[model samples]
Target: MAGDGTIEKVSIIISKGSLEGVYPGLIMANGARAEGIEANLFFTFFGLDAIHERRWERVRLATVGNPGLHLPTWVGALPGVSALMTRYMARRMDRLDIPPVPEFVEMIADTGAGLYACQASVDLFGYRREDFIGQVKDIITVGEFYDLAAGGQIIFT
Candidate 1:
């Protein structure tokens, strides 16, 4: 609380790698920063792909098993559905003037927000420090994330 029950900071934990999963956290963190709140993004588990050097741009919208698609699971599971949805969403975002993932990450970093990769996940995924994009501040443990998140709200996306 920032002296009147308003949030002053936020720690966003991203655990999903799908395009839909990663963007919410990014948008939230960016919104937090826009509101003058301190924001930190902690990428772990599959979320690691969002910050990965080789995987970020390739992340696809998860149509399969996603009820939000409002389609039968089998339909979503069909070949080319995910890619089509991903392209549609990407075009929509571009129309809305939203930057692509890499540029968005850089934009957020330029605003002084902290971006971190989970150390455990990095090791489990066999990723070196250099495997992340330049915007990632560091690979940190959960405890370290907690430390950075002190006196803030924690949002798991």
Candidate 2:
């Protein structure tokens, strides 16, 4: 374990599986690697979408059911509202100079953070190997992920 109780290796589990949740995991993993901590990120459930090659390009904000959205959760839940909200958020992010999700993923990958897509989730979602983005190291089972996460600082972000 590390002096601060952070282990020499850190495993991050990104389960939220949305555009909003994706950045924190990527950013944190990269930051951990920058600090000389070995880092790995497992993308499961909705997060698997972030690593999907076909769908990644279409990644959008989750307006509906997202309590953190600028609009009221009810408004976001309304049909067509989510799309508009997603577009609005994208525009706002652009104005704020925030990079897109794919760009952020690229940046994280550049830092040598290990990226994995959950094999079980992928199969459940009917995603083939070719559907995932290029940065994924491999498709791993939850048990395999646990093996890596064990004895390390495991964080679910």
Candidate 3:
């Protein structure tokens, strides 16, 4: 390891459908790229929402059970709370100039990062290959994912 202990690459699996879930993975991948490290993202299950052509722009936190919110899940589930929170978060992110999921995905793609979708998720959701963003390189099995991720730190988001 170097003095700062930087890894050469990172493989991230995004498995949540919520905005909160996808943001961390994107942020980490972007950070890794900025540091000149190889970064790859494999979107699976609900995480597929982050790469979904029709839904990526609309993903919001399913605050119903987000323990990090410090409020009763029921309170978050109440009518209108989710929308309000989503709007608030969007404005905050706007202030920071952080692009939305769609644009962020594009930005990462332009940076030479690889984006992948899970084949099992596509089968389970009844989605076709064309349903995801054009940047998706492939819909792969977990074993293939692991093979490509070998020797890299696998971070699950």
Highest TM-score against the true fold, candidate: 1
For model 2, give the RMSD to the true fold. 2.2
Deviation of model 1 at 135, angstroms = 1.1
Q: Can you tell me which runs of candidate 3 are displaced by over 4 Å?
A: 1-5
- Give per-residue CA lDDT, model 3, range 10-37, as digits (tens): 8999999898999999999999999988
Which pairs, if any, clash in model 1?
none
Q: What is the C-alpha lDDT of each candidate?
A: 0.93, 0.81, 0.91
TM-score, one value per model: 0.96, 0.85, 0.94
The ten-residue window of minimal lDDT in model 2 covers 64-73
> Model 1 — TM-score against the truth?
0.96
> Relative to the unseen true structure, what is the C-alpha lDDT of residue 141 in candidate 3, on a scale of 0 to 100?
94
lDDT, residue 151, candidate 1: 94
- List runs of model 1 lying over 4 Å from the truth: none
What is the alpha-carbon lDDT of model 3 when measured against the actual structure?
0.91
Task: Assess candidate 3 and give its TM-score to the true structure.
Answer: 0.94
Write out the backbone clash pairs for model 3.
Answer: none
